[model samples]
Target: MSPRKPDADVPPGLLLVDKAPGMTSHDVVARARRVLSVRKVGHAGTLDPMATGLLILGVGAATRLLGLVGGHDKTYEATIRLGQTTVTDDREGETLTTTSAAGIDDDAVRAALAAQTGPLQQVPSSVSAVKVAGRRSYDRVRAGETVELAPRSVTVHRLEVRGITRPTPDLVDVDVTVDCTAGTYIRAIARDAGAALGVGGHLTALRRTASGPFDVTRAAPVEEAAAALAAGGGPGVLPLTEAAATVFPVRAVSTEEATALAYGQRITATGIAGPHAAVDPAGRLVALVEDAGATARVAVGFPPAS
Candidate 1:
């Protein structure tokens, strides 16, 4: 690992966490702070407490990269209960209504899911984290107010019905896999699908499988991550060099060019796209650069000497 700057405290990089159920995303960050023993820690995306799976976190300097990471598409596996509606659109919320899904056939379920695939305008659930009047919609709902949220554009690239199970005449459980753009709400899809079929619906389970380039497969268990950090060992951050190369385009720079870029000087674009990583010969990240036609400008620089 490269040596930290004298003024640096904790190492800077990304940490991939496989979040456990019943833990909020902020709770994960709190645990990370305790383990890593540094105050600077931030997650790229928010995962609901009822949801579990991959969560990408940026520690120290890596925090700057989180905004870029959050925009990527995501994949999720979920269970939709096609018999009931909930205030929160998920199992965690109080049941608002119930209807028999006994007559709904596989064809009906397929047709409903098919309608939700592709581009559409979706109204997020009232009990969602979406900001309304600078307050969370969920918070407003909890305070006994009915929140009607505006519909937003979201894309569901793919929706595959994994399985269908009938535990009772009135209840149907549909397991599904979803690949969607950021800002999509799977719970809303469930709610809408059930509503369309004349049976209210809500999400029963949700597990994120992938977020951008990071997947649950590569994520460290939260407990294990904390233990590693508490032991005064590495916090399992994705190395800065690897993170930059994997998430963006790459440009190799000689030591001299790396120094120039670090010192805020522009270099010739190597025909690579703008916002590419400029790596030193030693494979360390030098900075993030953007192509300015004739010259490359520094977006963010990491001076090797520092």
Candidate 2:
């Protein structure tokens, strides 16, 4: 049976979970619902059971904000172990093969990583949640069906090499900071990087450094997140308005503009062009809008606005 609710006194919002290794992202969400005692819960993105890092969770009405969360860029710090291949594209898989990447120099390795540092196409690891023909890739893998996910374009703003360690003549660890679009798979980066170096590689450690404005600094471990809620503690998981404010291009809305949006009407273009975040005089975020049809129309809304 699942655990009972405990944080009955806490207000609902997002929880930045610094997920520990070995627990599935779903496990974290389940634990969080019990810890926060919220009737509604959801996770913004899925992290593999073996990987750990910042996992954003929505409590109560914040669940509606998941799609919004998806729009923001994400960052990660990961360690890829070179000279080996894995069925899972990660260390959790069976060791498929091994080779000595001993001759690969730091310059060549950096060049390989740098080659992937900009906007490029990326393929997800086979053992992933991506769906094909309306079925999850992992589900197919579980049922003994061969799965191959096609490459998709993803923007990689940065791929800073943090370090590299050679534990053995064959085993090497490369650390990287990834600032990229939402769908880029770090595991794929590892796989491709290894392929480039003439040696296979797989991810051994993963830590999401940031998602939009939320960083590791805002994240807490499962226990700590629970304790904070249980103690009648912590800040409102950045209300919808505030959370939206962090990413959207800012716009100021007049009373007329606010009224139009409040009544589900689009406002006229006041020579202000944007796919912008419109905030009321009260600091409540009103809508995300695009300058279309000669008016700044609401592309998305945030009412009960923060």
Candidate 3:
């Protein structure tokens, strides 16, 4: 059969992509736009060019949901190399210093990493995507400007040391799985841990395993998804209603309530929780709503696609 042509009928939805290394989050979105034939593609969170794994993308009107999705907790599998410090705090950066880490025992390594858990005021890597003085910190760094970013509050729910290996007498590599609130920097964790151990450190490898309720296991490789779309198959998108239900608490509403929400009017409070997905009898997502006194107000409304 011939491939499906891009048309207005493409549904608003979400795509779970298993991103490959060397592609930025924006690159994935651009590929999605070309294959899905819609210009409304947007990503929930960013994965660095050197990191790979689950990347959530919103399509069509679902772009409005990205903000909420980006704030959720995430999980990563990473390898931290003790004894090496780098400009970017990752292997992609130029080496700054190297110290002998052979003397650091597994117990000491665990202790240092344990200190990184719970609440933290982490200073992001100098090359992070964080904005500084209205420009990206990375951009400033590439321009030879020394940028000092203030520490930001973040939570590391868990840090499991998967294994510890000595690749050389001078270096130690620690494999770990991290569950952290949004904005927690794994690179910073490595840097801080190495600092505590009296050695330097940097991230060598990283991959996102999960984000919020979404897991990498459900993701399709970007190439595979795009190829399917180009071949006139389904874009493999999770419909907006299903996606919303997965991300937020569901509040089933009557047809009348759906109409009111679609019309920008408030409805009776669900009381289930604020930021719940309000769905109609037919299961179409009406809006993401929050309770205000006796009524629920739309945080983000999804009017029926015209």
Candidate 4:
């Protein structure tokens, strides 16, 4: 085997990409690596090939922050088609059933979706990226194995009906905006809501509008950003310190405290409720710290870039 390439020269930062439809989350990461010439790129979360929206890419040392970043709440705009159920719970999959939704009125749709709002147990789609028995659910499904996923606790903070339109006599398309906690599946929402109304449903479209403090509006188009990078212009990356501050509470530490934390020593309590970004006197991120009783301990530390 060839020797592994070193990523020591790659700058650590985050890139917010407005992913176009038909590209998987991994596809965007691959493109970033090629364009930015960085080998340590990874995405915080994955988006289906059929879905489009904001995708966060972490480069170099910033990859360490992705786990916490992926835990944040997310918002999405989706179009659910009532009357058709698909094997994957989305339009990309084979149609499993079709029932006329002519009798399903607007109020019925609204009420059914409203009922799905709040804390609930959600079964992820059988063809989801969720892992089962050490392999992806989708991989198992593709191998002709029946996949049954267990229900997970997820919260749907809001489900707003944007519009309801009938493209055909038997099919109704409902546009909705969902604000949900991490891991909430919008596809399952459509499926359950349609089942409640005596019809079947599947997602026709999905676009993530927001993830925590990052939004689609602030994301740069993937190709555009890549082109800029190739041309020696800005890569549109948010530097590490700024990205950390945007996602977590900020705690400015004294020079002495920064040194101690850098050496893996505990400092005084931050008084912050949760994990916070501790920045050195020079405004560089030193570590993510949380109070352990009366003292703050480093959850993750970033040694100064040499």
C-alpha displacement of 138 in model 1, angstroms? Answer: 0.9
Which residue pairs show collisions in model 4?
Answer: none
lDDT, candidate 1, 175-278, per-residue tens: 99999999999999999999999999999999999998888887787667645544434444476677788798888889999889878999997677658988
lDDT of 3 by residue, 1-306 (tens): 998755545677778889999999999999888776777789988999999999998877788888988899999999999999999999999999989998999999999999999999999998999999799999999999999999999999999999999999999999999999999999999999999998999999999999999888888887666555445444445778888999899999999999999988999987676599999999899999999989999999998872
Off by over 4 Å in 4: 1-5, 226-236
* lDDT agreement of model 4 with the native: 0.89
Candidate lDDT (C-alpha), each: 0.87, 0.80, 0.89, 0.89
Worst-scoring 10-residue span by lDDT in model 1 = 228-237
Residue 68, model 2: Cα distance from true site in angstroms? 2.2
- What's the TM-score of each model vs. the native? 0.93, 0.83, 0.93, 0.94
True lDDT of residue 42, candidate 4: 87
In candidate 2, what are the lDDT values of residues 1-306, reduced to their tens digit? 998645354544567789999899888888887766765778887888887788888765557667778667889899989899998889899999898999988998899999988888898988899999999898999899998889999999999999999989878899998999898899999999999998988999888878888887877887677557556455324554566566666788997788788777888764666567788898777778888767877777666522
Error of 3 at 218 (Å): 0.4
Query: Which structure is stronger by TM-score: 2 or 4?
Result: 4
